[model samples]
Target: MSLDVGAVSSSKNMGGFDESKEGAEKSGVQEVGDEKQGNVKRNMSDASMYATEDEEEDEEGNKIELGPQYTLKEQLEKDKDDESLRRWKEQLLGSVDISNVGETLEPEVKIISLSILSPDRSDIVLPIPENGKPKGLWFTLKEGCRYSLRFSFQVSNNIVSGLKYTNTVWKTGVKVDSTKEMIGTFSPQQEPYTHEMPEETTPSGFFARGSYSAKSKFLDDDNKCYLEINYTFDIRKDWAAT
Candidate 1:
């Protein structure tokens, strides 16, 4: 018995061997099916990932409370008699005008825009719907591409403590990744705050190209949810057509 060399070469060329696919195959990973290509519909599990974890304290295992929270007016008036301290407070609070603002108002944070940045390509800015609806197919990323998210937001009324961001991703009913990032505390100011997250590389090969659903939230230490977005994106063989 003998094997046909030409047949073996033809088969190898047709299948196209690559390190990613080789590992995926050995681990029982399969290519994304057609059913997984459709847009992910909204469900009850949108905020499930960060729901419980937000209650966890910081890494030092200490929940430090700096006395009671104060309103913007109260903070400004605490040391009004001292000219030097008043100047320092004014500089630290940016250009927020506390005269018209109510005395008991709480801090408010509004997310203005979100943009996706990829090397050698134009940024894809995603619009925030008025009613917080899940905008399906917000953007597409090429497999193995490096990308990052840029966020623009405004704070008003007071200071928001321990601001943070959380993102959870899922594919085909399975949780694929989860990320938690501390954005730091923010004070009310005239200009919006812009933050760009550290870059991340998407998975490659056949099993990695497919539609994914994600839940992203911006919250603070007080458990106040500033913004929560449920969106879907695609990881394709190449960058999507603009």
Candidate 2:
């Protein structure tokens, strides 16, 4: 069939050239594609994509977050209320390995490092040390192996009070009671808090002073274990200079 060559040069005018319904539809499709690309750019650039797996369910619930992808350069160009900074902090704090404590046999074994961080500055290195398993960043936790913990503390007047930590580390300490126990003020009363009460709203500062703790046990085959628990935790706060 012979085709009308005039249809090919729609961008230019022809004697009988007219904007057809199909042409409008094609234009709309192009516009939509452009919009979609724009959305991607915004999402990737926003600052709420950087929460820990569990904190992702925090009360802030589903709020957009900045993540690892966002960089300092982006922050310099973002809005004052930009979430990228918070996301950046979370990215810096990162995730912890709750799978298992390494060195199962080392009773003197300080199955020591169990931490849950949010803007928390300290690294959470759960001791799941296993032999010949490609140590550090190369192990995957087994299912049901993700044992849950209370991961909490006691408080008195905005400060942590008598802190108690109990976990089935190796079945050593008393059974872990989920209820919070009021630990008297931290040693020296004037403990340094992450200190969120900043004058101006700041992105957030890592307060290594505030202490938090969790209890863990390292049970042996004979229902025996050691109790050298320590739960010194710190808080991370976000702020913006108003």
Candidate 3:
């Protein structure tokens, strides 16, 4: 079965039509047996009968409304699992609003190198760790670590890159807000999800969100673009001893 994709964004007719019929009772001023004059026109189920109220079909069969189809956690979890998605998240992270805010991390590059063949087939070694700065360098590493690696990078009208990463088997790829935590391991696709859930149900998904991006542009020898990533992770207290 094909899964529905895309965000749920919609709008309702909050206001009325532009034309103003301030005092216009253009249509018949009243329904034959109604006391209210021309207030409304409703369709009646039986013979050519007109009702003077908005149709409120209490038993008009069942109406199915799909909404909030995916959760931020679901999206973030899928993003981490899919290589292509991780790239997009990293790109989105890169494009986050960065104006009028005191700088967070000093924008800088850790590695930049060009390929021998095309000069454009460059590779910047960028590794995002599980319990350290997922981006940027000079950050210390913690034991019991899991990480993602960007193997290669190329730049054009759009960016192209290769990637691979491992799951945090022992450290719980499943992360949640402080109050709630992953009590067990779960594979979203393994079993059927809840058939019917209340509206705005928080999705059970992964966290410890991290992203990485790399772009290559051919330039004179000294040309280079800095590459860095940022993430949050907890160090394994016992693993550090080993």
Candidate 4:
């Protein structure tokens, strides 16, 4: 079995080739208007509240560490009785019939870290939940500044050939727009891979202020999606206010 790993990064930059045309023609990109933006406001509100909870110090009153703080195996071992952990394990393993013992199983993929990068290539500190549950990854961006999205992950038993990314933008809880892009068709390997959104593709402009998410799907040689992950963040108009 070959281990496949895939990565995706996205941004809005001026003067890049219009890849959107080809992506649209291939039905690789899909967008929905405000009518389908329902409940986004509520979701953002919940995320904001969760961000506050994540900031609270432990009993010792020290700031909590950030980034990939724990692995699924560690969490499961720590709380074997946790129903949530069990459910997550099932999702990762997928459904398999007992009689299909000879069938090949999908490779397991683990996300190492997903974060935003400043123009200077430094990692921006965002509140990430230690247990992997979605939390508001909030950060400040100047009105017209650009930022890059970064993703890193590992695969167990397959080579990754490509990556599909879906990006959605929501403002004041309303989904303003969405886009999809394909990264590559590459050889398979096991070492960690880091993908960075092209500089010109980094998102910018005054209208970029909002809450957004990027969902990435790792694909194999057959163009079949094997592993997926999500990342959420908020673009604030002012860095000093929060």
Winning candidate number (TM-score): 1
Once superposed on the true structure, which residue ranges of model 4 sit more than 4 Å away at CA?
Answer: 1-105, 125-132, 186-188, 200-232, 240-242
Looking at candidate 3, the ten consecutive residues that score lowest on lDDT are 177-186
Write candidate 4's Cα lDDT for 122-145 as tens digits: 566444444533555544454444
- What TM value does model 3 have? 0.16
Error of 4 at 76 (Å): 36
Greater TM-score among 1 and 2 belongs to 1
TM-score: the better of candidates 2 and 4:
4
Clashes of each: 0, 37, 4, 13
Number of the top lDDT candidate: 1
Better of 1 and 4 by TM-score: 1
lDDT of each: 0.58, 0.22, 0.22, 0.40
lDDT of 3 by residue, 84-132 (tens): 8676554433333333211321121222221111122232233434343
Local lDDT at 86 for model 1: 79
Return the candidate ranking by TM-score, descending. Answer: 1, 4, 2, 3
The ten-residue window of minimal lDDT in model 4 covers 32-41
Cα lDDT, model 3, residue 127 = 47
lDDT-wise, the better of 1 and 3 is 1
